[model samples]
Target: MSKISAYILFLSLFLLAACDSAKKEFETLKEGEILLDINTEEYSLNGTVLGKTATDISVIDDVIDKPLYKELCDTRGKFLEEALGNGESIDIFELAKLHVDDNLSYVDFYKALSSMYFCGYSDFNIAIGTNYKDVFQLSIPRTDYMWCGLVIQRMKGLRYKYLRNRQKLSLSEMSEIDVEDRECVEEYKGLDLLLSFYRKDDGIAYVVSLNETFFNKGSRFDGYNFYTFNNDADLWKFIEDIRSKVDRQIGNMPGKKEDKVLRLLANAHGPNKVMLVFQKDVLMKDIAPIVKKLNTYGYRFAFDLD
Candidate 1:
């Protein structure tokens, strides 16, 4: 081959490779608003990329085949707009009372929402786990009028150290309970508040049903303990089943011993999705049944192994 021709061919290949790398790292998405038609191995969904990081992108838009404004959002669409519009400033700590105007299209509502808070985005369509045998179909919804959940599991059993010259909590403990978990289970100032967030100007919101909150509180010792899913019998059953399998595996381990209580923290997400942080090592198969069940029910999962 002639030197000139060979050099041209090598440059073409390099450009192509660089383009592909940019797509994977989402560098291409940062150029402008990108309309992505995604079919990830886990699920299929569409979104518009509004922002990007070195490894991830922000979904400022959701694309769906049908209108889910009514079935998806428990409130009237107009109410949602009023909550955000009204020409009034938003207090991220307010009760989020419903009050306002009569109409706003689904697209406009979401546009306003994304402008006010980042709660409106989903993590694109990443699979629950990296590798698994089962394949569950995907039915991604337009969450314009709806909310999605984020589960942050922390299993570092907590304790109440009464006194010893007004001892303060370590930074790690504070981070786990306050910052990492989004203050879901918090002792703010002095009040024990089992707070559930729906909108945030500087933080994130994870929806929690009123019934679920009452149930979690009922299961606690003094409205401040994290216990099993007492009200969610079916969910608890699935969790216990997974726990049984993982427990047996731990039993077979040579010299490992229990350190603290087995903690699983899942902030109630919009979909039935959850994020699990574990006390012991767990294989994909160990939790396959529930994971598959959730997938079957149109749910997704993300885990924190650290």
Candidate 2:
């Protein structure tokens, strides 16, 4: 055979082998689960990883090596010590608010953390320890709505804090309760608040729900159009103002109407965009008219998922 012919034959054989290997890998994946091709230039989801396929289930080495979990754990530990103190009697929810005000990044704190947990990069168990519920409340904060509950419960082992509404808490009275009790009472009042952090042998996850009432108290509107520019401050201010508006509107609405409205607004924004987080199951149908009113007032708007 000619030298060129031999070279061609070798190349064909190599291609055939590669094709066989790829096919075998593709066949091993399951439905619902996606296979990420981290080895290639494109991180394509070649096939399902969970439900059914032939791709072998193997952890991505690079994903396993992400230091985000460690960084988050360290940050949380420091935050806990500094904010709550070692044996200091302080409010957990308030501390969370303080952290949000002081250290949280505006671009993607919640979404990035959620992704890290979902991707198996962090150990949620170690990150949370005994404070899982409190962490969850602080992470998400809207538990009163039904839809928000669906999102929260889908993550792992998480429950919304429940607070019965009969107590009629004043603002100062509510603020003074211990973090855990405050979250519990808030939940019972048809307000869902959660803070979740979980870890297992493979990875870690952190989720928080912000108290809409508390968040709104700190938020303001600077009169920027929501449809244009997407100014960070303006966006945050609008959200804050919306929270206040929702609370007032809830007073007039009947039959769990308030929780529903809060949920819809919470679901509309991505983690970074969400200055306030709520429970997963709350209904949010009534807030549309209010949002329209804001739009009429010249607050431009856009929705983003982070």
Candidate 3:
């Protein structure tokens, strides 16, 4: 045989092997179950890694390591806009499947699954463990409108965090966070309005349902305490209240305005996440000042829905 012929045969065999491997990975995924594998050191779905795919050129505009999460919202929002034209609602799973292009990676697909809660697809049965064999087929019962459940399984350290309804949440759980026996949830009722999972040192997952009392009396959870704010005035008043509790000279130290403010605030409230709860009538213009101040001084803030 000629050298060129041998080389061509070898190349063809290699391509066939790669295609077979990709097919097996896809076959491992059951209906309604998303497999996000981190065994390749990068987030991979089936055999496609986010940055390794040709379609990932569009992801260059996104933040580092956060491209999928950002794209999850952007892509799903556009899909919802087109799917629900002049209609009140549509089947989420069907709409999602239709919009998923051949170029979509598994990481983006899993992130998209998590983003479904934003479109009111809340009910989910999440199970995270070491390998794909531990993942069960997600069975969502039919609701009055449609089926409303998704099962997400993380094979390894895929750094995806589902921030429920908020742009930023300090308490949100990242997919890679260690869990013995993947005890996050056997059957999470739903990621309804304010449902959150708080895992303690003892390895027990606590289902926290934040409500009006969280705003009125602040949150004291997991050995951390912090105040909540409904508006900019509430934030400033809390600042002033913190000032009153500390020594005047210390709180009003010269050349240390931001540091003094943070120190006193931390002293009054533990060094934990500060909650910002905007009332229904409050506009962005109303809370802009608070957000700016928090950003200016590097405050760890968490915004919650009313």
Give the number of the best model, judged by TM-score: 1
Clashing pairs in 1: 148-270, 149-269, 149-270
Writing each residue's lDDT as its tens digit, candidate 1 over 1-306 gives 999999999999997787556445432232111122212111111242222211121233342212222222322233446656666433322111110011212232222222222322232322223221243322223443311122121212222221112223343554555435434433321111121112235533221111122223233212222222323354446444544544443344354345222212121232134433321223333344444655654444443222
- Candidate 3 lDDT for residue 228: 35
Worst 10 residues of 1 by lDDT: 93-102
lDDT of 2 at 262: 55
Better of 1 and 3 by TM-score: 1
Decreasing TM-score order of the candidates? 1, 3, 2
| Model 1 ranges off by over 4 Å | 1-133, 136-271, 279-281
Summed over model 1, clashes come to: 3
- Deviation (Å) of 119 in candidate 2: 15
How far is 107's C-alpha from truth in model 2 (Å)? 9.6
Tens digits of per-residue lDDT, candidate 3, 255-297, equal 4655767666544443223444433233333344444454443
Error of 3 at 9 (Å): 33
